[model samples]
Each structure stands twice: as C-alpha cells, then as structure tokens.
Target: MNERVTPEPQRRRRRPTKQGIVLSQQLIIDTALRLVGQQGAGALTVRRLGISLGADPSAVYRYFRSTDDLLLAIADELIGRAQQGWQPTGDWRADLRAIGLRIHANYQAHPQAAMLAAHRTTGRTHEIAAVEAILGILRTAGFPGPEAVRIYHAFVDQSLGFAALDAAALALPAAARTADLQVWQASYARLDAATHPHITATAHLLATDMRRSGYPYALDLLLDAAEARLRAAG
Candidate 1:
C-alpha cells in the first residue's frame, strides 16, 4: 500500500515585473548598491529601493528581513570586491598591507556604501573569509592563536574605522568637500610660525596628506606595533 504525500505550500512572493527583471536577493542588493553609490546611504529606504527595482516595497522583504539585513549584504559585497584577485606573498606584512589598502580603496570607491555598513560584522561568507585571511596573515607572522586573534581584531577594526571616517568625508556634498579641502590650504597653510609653529612647519605635508586617505600609513603604524608585540613575546 502507498500513502499519499501532501505538498507544503510556499510563502507568497512578489512576482517579476512586466519588463522581465526577476526579483532576487542579488538583484535587490545590486540595486541597493547602485542607489547608495548614486544617491548616498540616505536614499536606501524600502520605498526608494522598491521604486528603483520597479517592484512593491514588500518585495524586498522577501529577500532581506529588514534594512539591516540589506546593509549586511552590501557590506559582504564590499568585502568580496576587495578580496578579488588578491594574491598572498610570503611576506605577511606586505600581504596584509595590500589587503588593507584594497579594503580602504573599495570603501572610498563607494563612499555611501561603506558608510552604510563598514562598522558592522556581517558574519556572512565574505566577511568570515576576510577575517580568516587576516588571522592567517597574523598567524603566519608568528603570532599564536590568541595573539593572532587579538591583532586581527585591532587591525580590522582600525582599518574599517578609518574607512568609515574617510568615507564620511568623501560622502559629503561637493561644496562641503571642497570647503573641507580649502580649510587645510587656507587656514592651516596661512598660520604663522609664531601662532602655530607646528602647523606652520608641516603645513605642506598636512595639505598634501590630509587630502588623501591615510589608511596606508596608519596600517603601517598598526603593523609595526603588532610586530613589536610579537618580538617582545618571543
């Protein structure tokens, strides 16, 4: 004797539009990235996303449970992009520096996208892979498991923290960005040695360096500190 099997009903999902663009999680994430790149993070609401996708606002909920979920996806996307084509050299410091710079550049490329989610730990595949890579670099550099984890935490946190700060500046309106640029030249450059000797002495360096992301130099400093600790423990 055979028993009849009952099929489970599926949840209702928004259908694709007349133009034939399917509504998938990747589509939503890509659309969200485009929205962020073009209009900044403030434009990433469900209504706005739906309008961008030409679907109902609820359609996005089918993929991401909330805005936070969408942001995490975006963050993972950023990490995946950064890690693309990355090759590791035997020199752990150089390899790690390359990764740090790539991550920083990726964030700068999509300033609003970074601002949306750089600080959060997405715990997704890409994020986990990045964490593993960094930890591996530290471990290869002779740091023990606990030491590697500690350095990895500091390295990643500091990198993303700088990325967020720099992205915030980049995400500013054109006029504001220009005004900020002008300040280093106009204000700092003009300061007399008597009033602000340090500023006067390093005004040129400040003007040149402040206009760019300082992540590379900062990463070097961080790597140096970690190296010192590693040597001290030996």
Candidate 2:
C-alpha cells in the first residue's frame, strides 16, 4: 500500500572526523615481515598481507611491485642485522668466519625467507655497507685493495651460497633430508685403507672435524694463505 518510496535508505554516515593513521610503506613491510615470520615466506602474498593488515589488497601493490621485491627488502634487512651482530675482534680470519656464521645463523633464524632470498641480489644500502666492512677488514689484515676485493667476493659467494643451501636443506621433506644424512653417514662409515690411509686411520676424527667445523677452519686457512702471499710480495 504504499507510497513506499521508503525514504531512500539513509546513506551510511562516516562515523567521525578523528585523524586515522594510514598505513605507510614501512608499516606494510613490517606487517609483511611478521607474516613471513609466522607463516613462512611461501605464504606471503600481497593479497594475504593486505588481508592481514585490514587494508585493500591493491594498496600493497603501491609499496611492492610484486612478492619478489618484498622478499628482497626482507633479505637486505636480515643480512644487515647479521652484519651488525658480528663484532670483528682484530683477527681478520676470525672476523670473516664470524661474518659467515652470522649469515648462516640469520638464515637459520628465518628459513623460508632465506630460501627465497638465496642468491638474490638486492644492491641495497646494507649490501654496500657489508662490502665496505669486508674491504676494511681485509685491508686491516694487510690485504692490498685488489686482493681484498677478490677475497671479499669469494667470501660473500660462499657465505650466502652456503646459508641458502642450509635453508633449503631445512625445508626439504623429512624423508629426503634423512636420505641426505644417510649419504653422509655412509661416507663417514667407509674409508678405503690403501688409497687413503690417513683418512682411514682417523676416520672418526676426520668425519667429525671436517663436516661443519671445517668451514671456519677452511676460511681461516685460506686467509692465512692470503696473508702468506701478501708477506711474500712485501
């Protein structure tokens, strides 16, 4: 019966004029980080992050062109933190190993993120800082500029490569990972006597010492060799 042009339903009135804090780029990155920390890197997407942040999904696009950009940012941040954690105590070999271990530990701290960033090149400010720091350490250790840069390149390749591999290993299915362990175990268990008497004689020690302990030792040895070469040149 009705002249029911039912008074046009009142438009929803905006609740108030209080200044609302809009999410900024830093906040988005921070939120994305928390999401990665909780759900792993694979779970991070612009839409999911936006959902988590209570924002329009397209908003995240303005901050990151895509997920890879977001990941690279995170990698730079994590690597920067790792660089900050290591205190170089005068010995270049020790300091370099400290850098390597810190990188390994940082990736281990966030396995998924590290995996995504494996071999990623950000050219970020922190990366430049890290290179500068390495060069400084090498120069302090008496490596001439060219030699320092060479060693710096090698060091960075191994540090990030190994860290990425370690992260991937962590992510591997348990059975596959266990199979890898089995291969290592098999190698450790059997050392031929005639061809490798030294290895056979100290198989246990060799296996235990060479596995993870040796990366640092190897790094130190290489640096010592570099030092010897430098001394010879001088």
Candidate 3:
C-alpha cells in the first residue's frame, strides 16, 4: 500500500493594511480625490496614495494596473457623481440642460481633478452610462440616428471644454486668480478709447460679464440651435 498523498495548501489572501483599514476601489478613488483637492493632481502618485491610505504602495497596483488606470477610474467617478440623483424630466431640452449643468458644476466643484480628467475618455461605467442617457434623450426628441450622434458629440465636448476652462481658472493660486479676475476692471477698463474703441466702449459691460462664466449662455445657444433644427426638420 502506498502512503496517502498530502494536498497542497492554498495561498493566503492579503490582509488589511497596517492601519487596519480595508481598501476598496471606491475608497482609493475617494482618497485620490481628496489628495488632489488638498494638494494638486501631481500629488496622486502610488507612493503618495499609499501614505494617505496607510497601505503598501504596491497595494494600489492590486486594484489598478497603473496610475493611468487609477486616473481613468477617477475620471469615471466624476461622471458618476454628476449623474447621481439625476432623473430625466421627459422634456428633452430640459433634460439636456440639467445634464450639462450637472456635469459642469461637478467638475467645477473638483477643480484639480477636473483639470486632470475633463479631457479624458474613460470608456468606463459612468462615462458609458452618460453617453447612453444623452443619446437616448436626443433620439427621443425625434432626431435621426446620425443627427443624434452629432448632437451628442457636440454637447459632451462643449460641456467638457467649458468645465476644463473654468476648472483651470479655479485651480490658480488665490492671488493670481484675484489678479486675473480684476484684469477687466483694472486694465481693460483703463484702455484708451482711441486705441481700443470697441473694448473701451464695452469696458463696463465686459468688467461685469467677464467675471461670470459664459458656459450658461453658450449652452443655451446650442440648445436653441438644436430646437431650431428640430422645428426645421418637421
């Protein structure tokens, strides 16, 4: 008779980090957002995240293959936040306006993260959901398939482009931001009428309007055009 063969033991799972905190994908993303907000996007390295989470730097690799993967996840998270609690109002124009405003506000809320992520294509869950929702709205509005796609493309790019611009301004140093905001009043308002007739004429209005975001007006113009297109299609 032969002796019974012994079975090999399975490998043990990795335990919690030194701080006794369990790591999850959501947690990592939240921590990264916080770090970026507190410092800047450059502060979101593996080592920095490890320190923040009190885990091994390599632990982040277990969840994300690389920092770029993590950044994509962060970008997707922003989309997810923007879509949170949002329900389509059945009026296509109203729904589109709400969606665009939500995206812009969320990005503005997280300026540093927005600066890094506004232009990224995550192709992840949240981003895909947003695309599906917008496309559905356009198609439901009686837009043809190709037309719906074109409108969706323009709407998304316009929202992201303005968000990035606004975020960049928000991310500047406090003093610099103040100076930039004051330029219209201090410099443009003082321009000689002869040398800059148009600017000088509009200086007061420019001082007021330039301080506010042009996104809302631009968004309305786009929607107005789409409305006209629908009417013309009829």
Candidate 3 lDDT tens digits, 72-148: 99999999999999999899999999999999999999999999999999999999999999999999999999999
The TM-score ranking, best first, is: 3, 1, 2
Quote each prediction's TM-score.
Answer: 0.89, 0.73, 0.93
Where does model 3 exceed 4 Å of error? 1-14
Pitting candidate 1 against candidate 2, the one with the higher TM-score is 1
Ranking by lDDT: 3, 1, 2
List the pairs of residues colliding in candidate 3.
none
- Could you give candidate 2's per-residue lDDT for residues 1-234 as a string of tens digits? 111111223322223212333655566667777787678765688767767767666655555666777777887887787887567799887787788778878877777778777588888887878878888999988888888888888888877777777777776777997777665457855868888788678777665553453355556676677778878978
Q: Please list the residue runs of candidate 1 whose C-alpha ends up more than 4 Å from where it truly belongs after superposition.
A: 1-15
Residue 212 error, candidate 2, Å: 4.1
User: Model 3: C-alpha RMSD to truth?
Assistant: 7.0
Task: State the local distance difference test value for candidate 2.
Answer: 0.71
Name the candidate, 2 or 3, with the larger lDDT value.
3
Local distance difference test values of all predictions, in order: 0.85, 0.71, 0.90
